[model samples]
Target: MKKVILFAVVLFGALIKAQDKTDSQFKYLEYDIEKIQNLYRNNKVTVKEVVEAYFKRINDIDKNGIQLNSVITTNPDAIKIADSLDHLDSKFKNKPLFGIPVLLKDNIDTHDKMPNTAGSLALKNSFPLQDSYLVKKLRDAGAVIIGKTNLSEWANFRGEKSTSGWSGLGGLTKNPYILNRNTCGSSAGSGAAISSNLGIIAIGTETNGSIVCPSSFNGIVGLKPTVGLISRQGIIPISSSQDTPGPMARTVKDIAISLGTMAGEDKNDKKTIGNTPFLHKDYTQFLTLTGLKGKRFGYVKGITKGANKKVDDLFLQTLKILEAQGATIVEIEKDWISPEISKNSFELMVSEFKDDLNDYLKSLGKNAAIKNIDELIAFNKNNKEELQYFGQEYLEISAKSNGKKDKNYKKAVTIAQKGSQQGIDSVIKKYNLDAIIAPTTAEAWKTDLKNGDNYENFYSSSSPAAIAGYPSITLPMGYINELPIGISFFAGKWEEGKLINMAYTFEQINPQRKVPQFLKE
Candidate 1:
């Protein structure tokens, strides 16, 4: 009888401990960087303690309870880094993100022991020869690099019909709001991690919709800055003309903070050599609750109308709020990019993928697999697990192309540039618009490996911005069922500062974000 009583007591104790841990883990899942910073300043929490708590939660829930699979590899050096930051002199306290933990989507290069695998087994143990420019900037700014997060293998550029966010190395990243829903593609982990509070913020790169799509699905703010605003030096490339790194976070203010730190010139990246003066040192100042006052924003009505009735209603609510705040709303009936431009974007990506990837591999020295595109295709064919889900149809198509020498490629580039500039830019100018607004994307759809990306009617916001290399930001507006949706604001070329200002204002006025309750009792 005594043994039975002792067993019952032990079991009860274990259950209580489990419950406590679970509750604690989910406590700050919705807290922003500012709230945590204030807490840390008041001695309510230590950086080291916060870092440890998040790591524990990630281990327990990320791939276990919720099975989100958002994180690719947790940094073993994270605790040490946080401890070092915590003990820094009082002067470091002023740093907006000092001791804040951040995650990087796996494709970004990290010089640490972590693998820059891009969610592929091809580079399973391969590490970068050097840190990516953005990673270097984050570490220098006193932010603790928490971990590498999962992504679509090869940034969803390998195959024609590849599944977004699924890779042989890290598996699929599930949306936090609903465990069964998709987290979208490419920079999938960045969105899921930030939305679920696995980290304060994350860095995600995009050739097209990778950052915004995942951000929309996960209900966070994602900013794809002017292509040259943030250096893409060490990142794996798709199209140098289009690929750029940006911030993904739960709020617009956090995104601004991240972009401020990362925007600048790098000696290694010639594209940013003359762009340092444009980077903002303090972005929080742009967060005026009344920023929407008197600003004329164009509504790309065509794309915003495609989301389900519920989503459209939510977007309409947001539009109404903007109007009430004294912002002028204008409907744009004819600003669509030509289909020819779209075709060009794809062609340019293919041409650059072959050249840029080969260049990157060569820079990897000895750790890289299959130096050129041909070798990579051959390697994938031989490795079933890495290439089984989707064949390298894009790669095969790219391989057959004449590369940069094709006249068709040249014409496509011209068309894309003109359509993005003359078409989208002219419309913004004609309307005297501060920004162009449209639906970022629809709600998260169910993931189907048997099929491909469940892409429905996403606004073609990415094209004009991407081709023009302009700045664009997307913020969560509302949810459909439990799956969240978002709307985007596109700023004219090299106008990230203005874009951030407007986005911050909108976020302050109408904060629609919330924490995900994945394992509620």
Candidate 2:
């Protein structure tokens, strides 16, 4: 017994020493996907080395240094998968995302060991039978499925006053820019992780501000594509009308590449069937440094005014840059989007959440922790940790909803679709615009569990496009006291190409993106 104990102690000490050495070796490795691929091709590094480096980085930063808690789980088989890819034929290595490590928001399904929990304790043990449609596409493109990320429980739709990045299963994901500030949800982990260089790329879903808001706060590029562009078949549900997965990354070029890999029609999702005309297998083809020239853009000044003064000043500079590039700017009125549309959209989400969530639970098979929302609510009530910060008020409200058959629900859907679509269409027609521009969201607010989100009258440009099922892209604009802000470009349905071009041009001209300093209060 004494001899065995001595051997165990020595082995554990060796493991700790090795981990410290690995962390120090790769602490400053560059995270650009193209650069990493070139190194692999030159035989200067292997896929396994990259995977191991990322794992070491995650351990150092996410698990220990700042305790970001951004990553919910890391793939145990990532090194093995990378080794297999490294051995593939040279011709096969030419894939768009060859050996690139990618992270998925927890709501996305994967048949691997990780659970699709959506940051909820109730579904912590549930495992899906297959990968999401986009996941399969990503795998086919030779991207490595790194792991799942933390999010707001149930994608921030669970309660009225809940905190953004706090989850029962994974805890709170802190903003990498400033430790005490919030990383907005429901794509919280994806934004923070990507900003901190934990992974090369990550996939995040947005019902409204989930992707863009977090991206804005964390200083990254987030693209919420038109609803049907990426199939939502295997993802845990929110509202079927507005839920879509998007790419969140550090560069527009990287986002363009990832968008191409994930955009396609899926047999399980009927909404994607007729979207072939808008789908592009190589979206990077449209990226140009001169894309802003000769393009007419509508500036939505109302929603852009109330944010930080530094952000506002930066936005004005951005407009000047566009004008210098020979792009026309049309100023738009404040009341572009109707109040009725906002009201109806909220009502629609309430009704759809019940129907969609129940269906998703049924799809999880009989082994799910909680079968439905009612059970989920009960589980939370019994588990104090789930309700330590906020109650499941939204879940309670959704459970009481008259599933999809209500006349009000139908009316709300029609009005929401009509209002949002017309609101964007009219502006484009009036200004002969390629897209509309606005600030993506407010600056990173202080994480306040007691008082909830510090944004009392927060106005986002994401809502109109989200409601219309249109594409919108947010890129880093500038900083306010080291906290990042973002500018958004959105357009009519299936106008992803236009938005991408405009955003890429803006990125090339300004190039203001900054890495996080991990400052603590």
Judging by TM-score against the true structure, name the best candidate. 2
lDDT of 1 by residue, 1-521 (tens): 00000000001111111122464546676777788898888989888898998898788778676667999999999999888878888788768678888999898888988988878778788788899888988888888898989998888888855677798799888777766567777899989888878899999998888888889878899999887888998898888888899999988888878788888988877768888677777776777665689999997554544435555677778889899999999988653566677777888878778888888778788757657788878878888887776778887877777777766777777777767777777888888988888777766666667676654543435667877778889987876665677888987777777877888888777787876655221
Tell me the tens digit of each residue's lDDT in model 2 across 362-402: 88888877788889889989999888888877788779888
Residue pairs with clashing backbones, model 1? none
**Angstrom error at residue 277, model 2:** 1.4
> Model 1: which ten-residue window has the lowest total lDDT?
1-10
Model 1 stretches with alpha carbons more than 4 Å out: 1-27, 304-307, 455-460, 519-521
TM-score of every candidate: 0.92, 0.94
lDDT of model 2 at residue 467?
Answer: 83
Off by over 4 Å in 2: 1-30, 302-307
lDDT of 1 at 307: 39
